[model samples]
Target: MFLDNLSAFLTHPVTGTVLLMVGIIGIALELLFFSSGLLALAGVAGFGLYFLGFYLAGFASFGDLAVLGLGLVLLILELVVPSFGILSVLGAICLFGGVLMASSDPKEAAFMLVIALLVAIVVVIAAIRTFKHRGIWNRFILKEQLTMSKGFTSSPDRSNLVGLTGEAITPLRPAGTALIQGERVDVVTHGSFISVNKAIIVVEVEGVRVVVKAADDQPNH
Candidate 1:
């Protein structure tokens, strides 16, 4: 008699629909928004109530509850740990299986599963777009912008070194170190190899690049 009453209450059309909606919405919200676990708790509670109702109605069994619990645990772990999407896939599969098993009618179960999946996808896409530009999302997504306004300079200005004379300290197969005014400076030769200890003159300085040529070589115009 007790079981019959419980089944009657749970199988009520309005109550069953409401419970399912609450569970779906709660889980979606929890996944999309970064709350202090309040949304997660609500989601868990909603799912718990949903399963309890189904069990009371004889539409679900203890095995169904176990499967659902496993799915929930896997999903939670996917969020907390980085499994490269492995956990997520497994969790989704478990959830689908559990939900299917919990429904007495195959058609109803299939319909509900489709609706739930579509809703989850839409919510996830929307959330990603909305939060993609935020700073908090940067930690998970790699984004970098280098601008002069941000004080990011790719190369230093070496124009001052122009016209300075230096002696090649190392062979410049177009690039090597030189001694300019007793200070070691990095420099590049002008299309020709310069031997060590040879006198060279800086003919051009572009950004951080110091271009030099043999002192006796005719300078290019």
Candidate 2:
């Protein structure tokens, strides 16, 4: 009984399109933000519901599911291991292909997929510009502005601070301010928390990122 209703609803163009949009957005959120698992779950549920309905209605074949699964696996692998966008592109193709195969009408499904993809892109852009959520984009997007083409020789010289010891003026719960070389500079520890007033030393400086380590943690020169 419930399956019948679900099948009917999912088969409709409008409802199905909405579901697809929601599913894509959810998946984008899962990939973009590194936070609570709720968004990821919601995205998974959207895909699950969409496919389940199609399966119950006999519109989705094992081949379609296999394609979608393969696509998703590639996308996840892209995140876990860097493939320089190769995996991402391939994954998106398979994902859309699978969804289109199970769709009642290929035309409507393609149109709807484009819309959802656009919306998801907008969401990602907004998230990148507005919030500092520190998600997958940090890895994917290049943030350095000081390049030779831009009239700057290097990424804002902070290399002089290397080997210099400093004091954490603020709590470095991995990221905070530290007094280094007589300047209050923004800094980050090596994935460890250093309490206020703890001794620290400059370790690595890449581009604008300043990495510090606990003074005691550093080996003797």
Candidate 3:
């Protein structure tokens, strides 16, 4: 009787939805926190169980499983290589299509899938915002790259100091710091040595490399 009850639950609509939600949350957690940790395994297992339940209930076909496998591959590729979210989107579509194929009732499957996704999104948001400060988050997620991935960035545009003039803060033996516009900036000379506190002028600017030369009273060549 216990075995029968377990089987019934496994085949239940709610169980399938819960499994899908777990799959989504697990994978998301793995990516956000684990990097290459056990959360990813949990996600894979969740998806596996979800499909397995449908198969045991005689609802999922081999073709459906194949599609799900393709989706998984796409998602993995999305992580390993940056495709600007294109691979991720395609993977999601494939997974959804697989779910539809595996369901005996397409409309009911879609409804459950939609509900699971909405709840997963809410759960993920809460985890990221409300519980982000909790110790558990830092333990799971790689915080080292968090700042660089989505935070304040250093300005790389040094084109403003192109025409500005300044003094050499350090001896520019082809590469040194100079005081440009009264501000000490890192500058480089074109194969010419610049002395300290020398009257230098900006000759050219190539991106962040501030090219400079001694301000000699001669033809402005």
Best candidate according to TM-score: 1
CA lDDT of each candidate?
A: 0.74, 0.79, 0.78
List model 2 lDDT by residue over 1-221, tens digit each. 98899898877777766777777777666666744656656766666667777888998988998998887777667657768779878987888898888776778778878887787788767877777547766766677776777777745688888989999999998999999878999999879999999999999998788999899884669
Kindly list the per-residue Cα lDDT of model 3 for residues 103-151, writing each as its tens digit.
Answer: 8888988988899899989988887786566533475577765443676
Ranking according to TM-score, highest score first = 1, 3, 2
What's the lDDT for candidate 1?
A: 0.74
Model 2, position 82: C-alpha lDDT score: 67
lDDT of 1 by residue, 108-215 (tens): 766765665566567567766876564235557648788878887888767888998989999999999999989898999767999999999999988888999998
> What lDDT score goes with residue 151 in model 1?
84
lDDT of 1 at 140: 75
My TM-score estimates for the predictions, one after another, are 0.70, 0.58, 0.59
Candidate 2 residue-wise lDDT at 177: 98
Model 1 segments more than 4 A misplaced: 1-14, 25-36, 115-144, 155-160, 180-183, 191-199, 205-209
lDDT of 2: 0.79
